[model samples]
Target: MPEIINISDAEDPRVAPYRDVRERDLVGREGLFIAEGEVVLRGLLDSSGHRPLSLLIAEKRIGGLADLLERVPADVPVYAAGQAVMDAIAGFPMHRGILGLGARAPGVAAADLLAGLPARALVMVLVGIANHDNVGGLFRNAAAFGVDAVLLDTTSCDPLYRKAIRVSVGAALQVPFARLGAGEDALDVLEAAGFTSFALTPSGTLALAQVRRPARTAVLFGAEGPGLPAEIMARCAGVRIQMSAGFDSLNVATSSGIVLHHLAEAIA
Candidate 1:
């Protein structure tokens, strides 16, 4: 069991990393991130690439989380505070009563990540996806479909963001993801790994159902409005989901789910 320290004051220095979570989220947390709610905390504990540095929970929640607390390493500090103090420390009414400070492991290179995958694999490549919700949703879809990995371009937002983690329901923490290095092309890496790259777009030359699933597949999705750049799509086989006559596009997250579901079904 981990030691549970009682914190009477909101200004306790031990819990400083969790202060003004919303504000800290905007400026960034150096190498640390705040994991909110019970579900996300559980994810933080289970994640291999990220480790919980400390935990802050409302005193009332301690009894309910006893089993979960046992899973935490004995060396990590778990702090408990009253409801008012918890709210004051969080700069809001934290109804969930659970927060964890976690540190990300050193980033893995895209080449290393792709090279580590098995012969039969499915992966998602995200480019210029800046929305936290979309990034989270993509991770959720990736996890649901058993994607081998997710590759993000430099312009993509961090999946470890608090809002993204909440929206993903902890999937972000479970999925293995890596970012492309400076000036590195996603297609180059996928192609080098013998993956058949598919660029999902409204103007795709072939419908998603028409193409047979490859032994190794990489589905590329870009930001919603602009969609995948024509140049990038040109390099990969263009595939599209059949939709209604009027709608030309779907939210990136929704598109990803649809595409991933199709790929998963194809494999099954």
Candidate 2:
């Protein structure tokens, strides 16, 4: 367990980074990301690649998190604040008292993430998914379905966003992920790596069940309204979840859950 440094003041310099968390999208860009809740914090501590800088929790909730606390690094500062102070610092009422600040180990590359995977991998690829909540939900779905890794194009929202991490229930911290450049070169890379890429869309050429089982599969999901780009669809096998015609689509996250669940069954 770590030493519990008490935080009585919301403006205390030691707790400065946590202030105005929702506003900090890391747009001005610090490599740091905050993980919320004990479940998410536990995920951060358990992940070998994501290193925690510090942890903060409400004083009243400390006892409830004893086992989770033991997993945090001894050197990491574990700040404990009272309820009022916690609410003041967060700018809202926080039912879940745990928060962890984490960063990816420096110099980690897409290739490195790709290289370590098992021979048969089931991955999710996202493009133009700007909504943090949706992005977070997709990550949660990916984690639930035992996805091997997640690859995001330039247009996707950062999975490390605080809201996304919270929505994911810490799946963002648990899952392996990497980013691709603006171009569609990643598709070619996937093909070279023996991945059978599938672009998911409502008008997809084949129903998901109809497609042959792929040994190493990567499913591409795009933004909610526009869906996957035609160029992207052209680059891979097109797959659709069989939904009723009256409705145009399922929520991106919900569709991902359905697709990945089916894929997981095939993977197993």
Candidate 3:
């Protein structure tokens, strides 16, 4: 069994890092990512890119994590506390008794990421996607549909955000991503990387079925309400899914799934 530290006081400085758990992003500290639920926690620990600093396991549910506990590094701290105390620390209930703390891996630069990628790759790029859950789902869908990487453009939420990590079910931990600060810069970077960027838009002139699937493709999606910026879409190749005219556009993540699925098939 891993060494367990019994935590009694929620205000203890030793547990300070875990305090005000509900509003963690507002904590002002950088590079911290939280994983909740045993499945996601285990995924983070097992993934090569992520390393957990510690874990807060509910004392009542330790029995459920016997196998995972055995696999955790002996040196990693396991803070065990009663349900009420755990609730107090996290500022909520129903965490499934397993939360892991880990330092986020340093972000990879877009240039370096492109240099390291295989000659032919498929990347999913998010444009102005603000919802963390939607961003997380996009990562999950990208991973599932054979996207080689995820790129974030202006206004997109951080994929490593705590809610994003949990919402992605840890897929964010495993998927490769890099943030591009501006839309113009993102397009230039993709071009320099030898990637053909495709913007998915409802008003796109070409149907998705007609576009040439390149050996290297980057698919870009924006949020639902505003959709892709007209200026941004003008700078890249454009394609839209053929759906019923009366039906509104798909959610950004779902559109990404559709694009990635087709791209995966094209690549295969």
Candidate 4:
């Protein structure tokens, strides 16, 4: 069992990492990330890709989380605080009263992640997806469909963002992801790995359902309004979801789920 420390003061130096979360979230957490709520914390404990540094919980909630706490590594510090102190430390009311500070495992290059995949594989590539909620939703969908991995362009938001982790219900922690190095082209990597890349776009030349699933498939999604760039789509096979007359596109996250579901069914 991990040691449980009691925190009476919000400013206690030991708990400084959890202080002013909102402010730190804007500025970035150095190498650490905040995992919020019971579900995300549970995900943290279960994930091998992230290491939990510490946990902060409301004193009242400790009994309920005893079994969950047992899974935490012996050396990790677990801190308990009253609701008021918790709120003060976080600079907001933490109703669920569970927060974890975690560090991501050492970075894996995009090429390495792709090379490690089995012969038959499915992956998602995200480009310029800045919205945290959308990024989270994409991971949740990717996990649901058993995607081999997710590759993000450098412009995308961090999946480890607190809100993204909460939004994904911890799927972000479970899924393997790597961002492209600056100036690296996503298609070049996929193509070199023998993946048939499909760019999802409103003006795609072929309907998504028409294309046969490839042994190694990589689906590319871009930001909602702009969708995938024409140049990028030109390099990959353009695929579209059939929609009503007036609607040219769907929300990026929603579109990802639909596309992933189709591909998953094909694989099944």
lDDT tens digits by residue: candidate 1, 1-268 = 6888999999999989988898887885778888899988898899988989999999999999988999999788999999999999999999999999999878899889889999999989999999999999999999999999999999999998989988998888888899998889999999999999999988899898887779999999999888888889889899988999986668889888988988988862
What TM-score does model 3 achieve against the real structure?
A: 0.93
RMSD of each: 1.2, 1.6, 1.9, 1.2
lDDT of each: 0.90, 0.85, 0.83, 0.91
Residue 140 in model 1: shift from native, Å? 0.8
Between candidates 2 and 3, the one scoring higher on TM-score is 2
Model 3 lDDT, full chain set:
0.83
On lDDT, who's better, 2 or 3? 2
How well does each candidate superpose onto the true structure, as a TM-score? 0.97, 0.95, 0.93, 0.97
TM-score of decoy 1: 0.97
Evaluate residue 33 in candidate 4 and report its C-alpha lDDT on the 0 to 100 scale.
Answer: 93
**Tens-place lDDT digits, model 2, residues 1-268:** 7789999999999888788777776555478888888788888988867899998899999998889888777889999999889888877887788777788645344556667788878889998999999999999999999998999988899888888988999898888898886554668768777788999988888898876657788899999899988888888888899878797668999999989988988653
Please state the error at residue 113 of candidate 3 in Å. 0.9
